[model samples]
Target chain A: MTTKAKRSRLDLRNGRIDLSHGAGGCATDQLVKGIFHRAFDNDWLRAGNDQSAFAVPAGCMVMTTDSYVVSPLFFPGGNIGSLAVHGTINDIAMAGACPLYLSAGFIIEEGFPLADLNRIADAMGAASRAAGVPIITGDTKVVERGKADGVFISTSGIGMIRAGLDLRSDAARPGDAVIISGSIGDHGVAVMSKRENLDFDTDIISDCAALHGLVAAMVEVAGSSIRLMRDPTRGGLAATLNEIANASNVGLRIDEETIPIKPEVAAACELLGLDPLNVANEGKLVVLVAPEFANALLAVMRAHPLGAQAALIGHAEDDDHCFVQMATSFGGSRIVDWLWGEQLPRIC
Target chain B: MTTKAKRSRLDLRNGRIDLSHGAGGCATDQLVKGIFHRAFDNDWLRAGNDQSAFAVPAGCMVMTTDSYVVSPLFFPGGNIGSLAVHGTINDIAMAGACPLYLSAGFIIEEGFPLADLNRIADAMGAASRAAGVPIITGDTKVVERGKADGVFISTSGIGMIRAGLDLRSDAARPGDAVIISGSIGDHGVAVMSKRENLDFDTDIISDCAALHGLVAAMVEVAGSSIRLMRDPTRGGLAATLNEIANASNVGLRIDEETIPIKPEVAAACELLGLDPLNVANEGKLVVLVAPEFANALLAVMRAHPLGAQAALIGHAEDDDHCFVQMATSFGGSRIVDWLWGEQLPRIC
Candidate 1:
């Protein structure tokens, strides 16, 4: 059967998409079975129904969704396909849950190359398999030429929160410690390099990755002591800390010297006149843990590959104004304000 | 509080969306609170977390997703907003489940009017409220102008199916009755009319609606008798029937005269040189039920407002070829094959 399909496969290397791909006809079925199904093959998807029905254990469920409109569909170290999967999985993980299933929806341009679509599906499938999460159900729609970019992917993920784990942004206490999993601004700089056609001597790869495993490892050590976990994707660390401060009604104090950034990424940010503090990092996490368990949580995080450069950057304190202040390396303190406007667009 | 927000409200009437609306900063927060949150206010959404966590009843869970890229975002009787809500809800209902929640992901083009965004969100909120389902969690991303058409919505829905209720397209037996909820071709025609700027003397409205209520009513009367159910949305009745026939390995015989289609919709299909059976109907459903309970199910469906035109248009039978034959009103028999090409693009 595999050989038969391959023999009459789509002209992936040269074929252009047509309206029939989204017409809900035999052509649509061929696209689904020939490409999508072959890549994300799973029992739930093979059920072949309008919806996938399955049993869930009795517990609290967490659901999150993200849309990826990152330009230059193919980027350094990652593409829109992998970013869609990783972004949603990270959202589910932020709640201290075990990410389980994902549903993908794609909007493709009418004349998009079939090869590009196949490559994307393959990448998504690989990411899902690596994370042990399945792409159980999906949808695809095609718009006329120029109506859409090359492709945009929207992924929604559901996960199960284990018993006795309570992680919320508002749970942060004044004495809690703020820890960062790894370096920042890698994802933003990497995508910018490709979109702007800038050449960096050092390879700047996107830090996009699934973080549930790291979250699970940390939970094993500091289950309830952890107050909050956030992946600072869009607004970066500065915005994330500000949000936490407001949500918990506490002030955050950070040391600029303690924050870590790849030298290559820093140079790129400097060249682009962008602030690393406000740049996105797809694979990193910001955690707020009780002061007593901060070291243990950091140790657990560092043990994971995705969190090799973990660092304790700040702590929460009581403040009526809920401000986030950072002690600069130049011996001055500055308020880390919420991002006021767009700094970078389509960086994912 | 409302007055305060309104006093400093976004210039919905004239303001254009900027990349800042999706930058995960104060601007993004304002857009969310002013437009999205205000419209989709609910306890779960109010929590303001990356994901929404909620307890679920123990049962089989059904999940479905769809991406809506319909052109002319606004059309007669419905718009992309309501269509997004109705489309996903119907997908879940087709699996014989009561939709519990929805997660929405939106990709908006920069420079789009804030008024249009608010209107779309308002329509979604209204549709969700009317369907008794909450938009529990969501995400928003913005692309540069020309990177997206205007606004694309991806909705993923989760629903709960009671124990012992099994609905599968492949479960259709040879002796099942084929039933349709209401008039076909309305949605496709309505959207086409708007896209082509062609107005009909008679108002033709898209039949875009949430059909979970109708499904629940029918389930109440004929739970065990239902073999399968589907919404003839994109490829219309022809594609749906063909899919069922192939899936269940059975043959279908339909009487074209029994298939209900609005007069205006039929005339529009003829004017556009399209087949009514191949046009979409957002609010309609195609069900295969045991022949014995067909009348009871039709009675229940007709009692609902969305299914006032319910009719039993066909039946299933054994055939090695798994073909779908239609008896035309002109005393001729023809094969109702799967849609070969695009009938109407971006009709939802």
Candidate 2:
């Protein structure tokens, strides 16, 4: 009867994941205690129960989930680990909530490198700590080789919405001002460069960072004045704006010159024949606020590091068509349509 | 500017999933409205927010998450969809909580059939409705073909524990009686039969079910006397017992003859060279309760539809080694150990 203390340490540097890591046995316990437990290191997780028990504050609760299957698990600036944490946190924060706790589920392909898994866990732990959120409970499963990609992470988060704040997609009004937190297309281009093996003189890094603090700051300054908030992810700014337009039954008018895009991302989009407006951004958020509070909200956003590139890029109007029209730098107007097909796959 | 009402219907019968379905664009909206929305129709889901916001009752909350990558999405008596729902529900119920809401995250392989996806969603919806728990929020991501098996569903569930109940894994005490709700190994054998393409004279159906009602009934009868409860999943009954023994620092003495096993499942396990105690059971639960209330708890469990075959299988004792010893039907004693490796991968 070998106790956990007597078991030898896992071969973290060179060993590959075997079926036992997720078989719910001794090996699985060792993997969890050695890797996941050490990384997450929370009291709730240490309870060793199938579920994490906690107390909920008296307020509206928000819940959201996302699965990260981004290819080339290791991307510039962030990997699937950090992306999984930040993505769900941002989703909850978009509801004007203070992110509370998260639960992670991991599916690892058999023979995946233990070192890589360790790195991903480390990144996830770092991201969770940075955002002041803890991963209270989690599950891990391993599949046969080729039955799964290297690894896929699914994260679900619970948050508490601030009282008196009623933010919803349908809350936008005709006079609302549309603001973006930062440059777009960086996350998509960064992942594409690594996946397609494209190289450029300048580095393109994914803008994957937790935005809950930035959202907290914004909500502090303008609580009910903010109509809605969304993180431009898979379908990017174009899809987000279109969703808002359709949901709110309003039209949007944006100045192309005001939208920020990194030069490397712009060049990559041109070379790849992709629209920068349709590319994803992990760390950026778009907010629609009442006209009177837009400037003050923008000022508050600019004070946060994640929102240093904040800009008011658009405005909503009462148009029967419910279209998102962009005033191009060429002095021509064109509709920013939703992405037609897969511009990029597995970009998280 | 085609509104959702005007958009053409999805080709659910013959169309295959494309990257566009998960692109978070118009196509994604169509998929959501056509399939997910129609299946999981609820006011919170229809709110069209990135996160679902709702009021939670004041109590201790239990949260659990599990990712289902079961091969052959469809199996006898259940599929991955229903299994995903039941598995998480049981996890939360084991903590003596009333399951509340769930959030689903799906990773689909490009070119997968839309019909199958719809079927899975339908099963999930049925399961959610049957359990009285709504899947309020969800996310979808599509990966390139060969990057994913077919579809993997990760579900996170939140439940509210009744006031004054404190269940923990380490709560077992000497003289606690160990009870099992029903026959084990049906789920694992059912999945293995499909995966291995084995035939049997009698049908072996998976015992995947939501156990919240059974737990509630038992809690009503033996509230404080109930030390702990767990569903023997993944590594199965042997692993679950070992976990409890280690956590509570107590030993277990089991009578193998008293443990229930369906003849077909027993035959299947024998033929496959698997131990019945080491196979998964989705609908079953193992409870440790005070000795004085063991009969009352067993009667209550047996009265429930999900626990018709409930039996008292063992008892806890104080031992320095904290081992689980089984008195075999052959009059020999053997230690029950945790599964060393995967008995059957992707068994859910």
Candidate 3:
């Protein structure tokens, strides 16, 4: 409140945060001006409008919104900022759409570091640009110092859908085959490693990449074998598989040996007393395909860098209970129930 | 960490959060089963599937996503839950669409009152039903005790865009008039009043209602003249007008007296030393128009209860900097600058 306190704040690095940081005036401006805006400087963001105004390419547009509240905002390979872009872009792409614009609304804790804020914003901007989408407009609000944690990003994305492709979870049909675009649980384990500070003796980078490009590739190849697609996010593969099974009124038979799991993830799960299947994944998709095209789809998926570890793991069968049964690794069988509860809360 | 802690926790209601709450296991399951799943019970939600499968009416569909973390989740007229639905629906409706299915993602603090969450979810469900939309899918995650406030709701909405309405913010044109659907700042003031605990209160409930029906009405009547529409959510009218002005490359001339403001809002602003222009409005919108159809648009908007206070707020003028000059209540003038400082943080 006084010049003395302000001057003392000079001693604190951009890495530190104090009560005054969230004050709704010059202090807050310094945070936005001296850091956030600088790192996120771009034509759309610099315009400083409440909502970004941009041209949507002529066609049917797709819009999606996601809120990112990952704990330990600074994670191993990714943070909440980049996670926001990846999540929203995937939602748009899952609908057979091309992501075009984004709107970011930030809820910041009062005493968050300017440096950390800069890193997050830059990460978001970079991720958006790399995905060929732009962070078009934004809103920022700072709650009391103890009222929030670091920062939370809520993103609303608008995209355009090309003609003809309609993607939905309910599209899965009886007898449809199941395939995974790549290895599962890499992202969940990476974030878990960062949060727990567990020894990452075996470097496990988060598989937190945008999937719109991969979705585009799949659409180009499989015209229609893609009965359904979903990114197994929070509850991971078990949850996604169970969802599709129930939605289509079918049971899935997943071969345990065919499923891909990075050794690091498997090892981490063992240490934490958790299941790799229940862990989160930011860059893997569960694809349901018609039986005839299952192998062809897997081949197409395996061709891409993102899909290099693709696998045909399961098949659909007639069943009202929507069971997700799996052949056990040790040669037994078990029902993979819908991941019944929260795994890691707010881990993006 | 022990079996006693898990079994004993089944009946306790007043206990505080411990570390196991954040651990990914049975503890999290007890919490979701006891609190979240109980509050949000419905056929699709109760199905316990990871993703909800649902249907939609025939037409071009519109989907929107918004996250609400407004401080003091309980406001004058609503909580974060209802606001989440209203905000996302307004976005879809702003596209001249009818909202259909909704999905919600929540980040909740561990000690949040189950009763409060139940009430909020009920409100959201009621709002959805009233808007003729269903919250077909949702998710709940419990953050560590200090990582979040009571709760934050992110809703993704899908709707059917009516035929022939090409609605977009970029659709504003030169010589188009600007109309506000109703009084501004009610929602922002309502939340702020509740937050600050100001005794100076009126029954100034948040004008936080769904605008889809009102939008549908306007779209039916003002079809082509309705060049652009934007709800003044974060930055309020001043910021929204400025955005439209710059987007259309036209300056705006507005009559101060012509803009609608409730008596309570005006009094509250004067007492709090705040400007209503910079306050957010959840229920109000800035509707751009062609000169000739301004009256018809106002008539249509006024026909609805939500738009009863609709008025011609401004008109497009020729200027490059996009100055938003207002004709004062006293017939003099002043520039309505963009909200240069934070009005209220997390005011939603």
Candidate 4:
């Protein structure tokens, strides 16, 4: 009988993934020990159990999950691996929580390059480490070649909510002030630019970064006054505002002039006939705060590097119909409606 | 402006999944509220926040994740949805943890039938409810046609460890007893029978079940003396036993005559030219316990419906090389080595 120590190392440079790598056998063990174990080297993972057991602090815990199927697994600024980490971390951060750890589930198609898989895992590890959140445990499964896109990653994060902070979507009142952390449409445009059909030249990069630090700063300053926070991801600012308005049962009024948009992203959105308001942004947040704390919160947001482009763009008011109305730069007002359908598919 | 109330209802009967349902827009909202909300109805989901927040009991927590890509999603006893929940829950249960909540992430292929999707979600709801665990958070993403086969579900579960119980894969000591909860190979045979290439008729049903109850009973009876527990899912008894042997650095010796195998499963394995020890069983467990408590634990296992056929299969022994040796019914012994490659792909 061949010992595990005598088994061959994975052909990381030239080999490709096959059915056996996920079949819960020697090959699967080797792939896990060689690739995942190397990338996510931590005590919990090294324990090598079906589950990762750890001691979490006593507090209100938040859980969130997101599945990243972004096309062109490799994108500008970050790939799917990094995006998966940031997206789920941001979800926890939206609850005024400090993300503790993450669990990743990968579904890889048969024949995917081993090198690419290694790169993705490394990126995931780097992102998690940078955010101080580790990928504690994970599961991998492989499908037939035609059954899946190259790869898809689903991540679930658990976080500890800050003490005395209860941020809820319905917590916003009629007099709350609305703020946005940064520019919109960069992530969508960056991914779109890489697509084969779009022929636009732009240097836009996806603003995909863990936002817990900025959230921590905001919580430190205005924990009680902050109504809620949301990252405008898939359907962008328009969808986010509409949802907030509906959930809070209040009308939101914003000035389109105050909304930040990079020149390249604006031009690309115009060329592509996509509204900047409806384009996705990965590293932006829409925040609602009490009217009295609006200026202080804005100042705090702008103090952080991630919130350098922060703007107090809107306010909430009583309306029988919870409409998000925007004062357009064209000297006219229009309803910032919820996105009706698919604007950009697979744009994480 | 069209109000949300004016939107048309989702046609659950005849509608097919489209890109818009996963685009995080009004369509996505409708699908979520109309289908998932009604299925996994709970307070956390009703809050409609990006994350679910709740106070958890202070203790060591176990987090586990699994992405289910079972072929022919609808099996005899259960579908992919229930299986996803059971699989992750079992992972946690193996660590003697009481699963608290679950987060589901679904990746669906475009043009898939909404009726089928609803059925899957309902099955998930029913499974979680029956298990006394709730699906507190979830995500949905749709891919282009043929990018995915039907649907894939990834679930993450967090569970609180039972205070005083610490089950580790490497905790098995020499002179410990190895026990199997029930017969093996039922799940694999059941799935393979439904495949197109295989022409066979049998009343075999997949042993897809949540084994938390049995685990709780074992913890109640032999918590301190239990070394470890593992579900023989993918590579079956051989793979699980081999993993235990390698992790604990102890040799395992078992008599083939004592291993529980249903006559039908044995016949099916014989016809398929497969070893019963190498076929998967979703609801079976291979447990290692101290020799003093082996009989007591086996009696308690036999009392549970899920473990009616509990058997004391083997014993761990000291050896320079950690090997799993089994005495065959023909009075010969052979190494029950780790499975080399894919016996059944997508068996989970």
lDDT of 4 by residue, A96-206 (tens): 999999999999999999999999999999999999999999998999899999999999999999889999898889989999999999999989888745666657889
Q: How well is candidate 2 docked (DockQ)?
A: 0.66
Q: Candidates ranked by DockQ, best first?
A: 4, 2, 1, 3
Better-scoring candidate (DockQ), 2 or 4: 4
Better of 1 and 4 by TM-score: 4
DockQ for each numbered candidate: 0.57, 0.66, 0.17, 0.75
lDDT of 1 by residue, A1-348 (tens): 111232334677898788888888777788888888889999777777778988898889999999998888999888899999999999999999999899999899999999999999999999999999999999989998888899999999999998899787799999999999999999999999998999999999999999999999999999999998999999899889988999999999999999999999999999999999999989999999999999989898889998899999999999978989999999999888777768888878
Ranking by lDDT: 2, 4, 1, 3
Compute each candidate's TM-score over C-alphas: 0.97, 0.98, 0.77, 0.98
Q: Write the per-residue lDDT of candidate 3 for residues A172-252, one digit (tens) a residue.
A: 777888898888888888887888888868988888888888888888888676787888887778877866776678889
Which wins on DockQ, candidate 1 or candidate 3? 1
Model 1 residue A140 CA deviation (Å) reads 0.7
Against the hidden true structure, what lDDT does model 4 obtain? 0.91
- Candidate 1 lDDT, B1-348, residue by residue in tens: 111232344788998888988888887888888888889889877778989998987779998999999989999988899999999999999999999999999999999999999999999999999999999999988888887889999999999996679988789898899999999999899989999999898999999999999999999999978999999999999989988999999999999999998888889888989899999889999999999999999999999998999999999999977889999999999988786568788878
Off by over 4 Å in 2: A1-8, B1-8
lDDT of residue B178 for candidate 1: 96
